[model samples]
Target: MLHMTCKGKIHRARVTEANLDYVGSISIDEQLMEAASIRPFEMVQINGLRSAQTWQTYTIPAPYGSGEICVNGPPAHLFRVGDLVIILSVGFFTESDLERFQHRTVLVDEQNHLVDVKTYTRQSAHHIRGGEGK
Candidate 1:
């Protein structure tokens, strides 16, 4: 059996633009995508920190080092420039894969520059559960 699991995440990324005139999808810096192993056009889940809104969208590659994080199409109305958001992508994994699976979580500065990249593995999962007193 395959389980859907988080593949990568971009945390606290600032929105650089919101284009109501554009079609759809979130445009992210290609460098950031590469660092997180996120593919272009991959489905993503976005959580707006300030607006408290959560939505699903796909990703598009912007220029490397562009620091772009834009909300396009109708969803543009749901976000504002400078809004901090969390972007995530998920994929299916088998039981064996889960044992060694690693997910990347990227932290970015206000300008959307990469600050840190954290890898979560099965060991990290244990630590998380332990922290929760589970």
Candidate 2:
């Protein structure tokens, strides 16, 4: 059987832009995307901590080290600049795959710069070495 599980998360990233005129999708810094194991055009679910809003969207890579987190299209009206939000990507995993599955966590500072990275299992968590746009 396959179980839906979280694959990666970018925690507490401060929103830096909102372009309501754009088509759709969230623009994330390349560095942040890599750290969180999120691929370009991958679907992600975002929770706006301040507005208590949840929305689904795909990702677009911004310039590396740009500290960019832009909400485009309709979501722009819900999640605005300076709002802290959580971005998550999920996948379906088999029971065996869950044994060694480690969810990638990318923690960013207020400016959206990478602060640390972690890997977590159902059992425990470990801090991995951090690099790129730190």
Report the Cα lDDT for candidate 1: 0.87
Q: Flag regions of model 1 displaced more than 4 Å.
A: 128-134
Q: Write the per-residue lDDT of candidate 2 for residues 8-109, one digit (tens) a residue.
A: 999899999999999999999999999998999999999988999999999999999899999999999999889999999988999999998989889898
* Cα shift from native, residue 131, model 2 (Å): 21
Worst 10 residues of 2 by lDDT: 125-134
Which pairs of residues collide in candidate 1? none
Which pairs clash inside model 2?
A: none
Model 1 deviation from native, Cα RMSD in Å: 3.2
Error of 1 at 16 (Å): 0.4
Count of clashing residue pairs in every prediction: 0, 0
Best by lDDT: 2
Assess each prediction's global lDDT (C-alpha) against the native: 0.87, 0.91
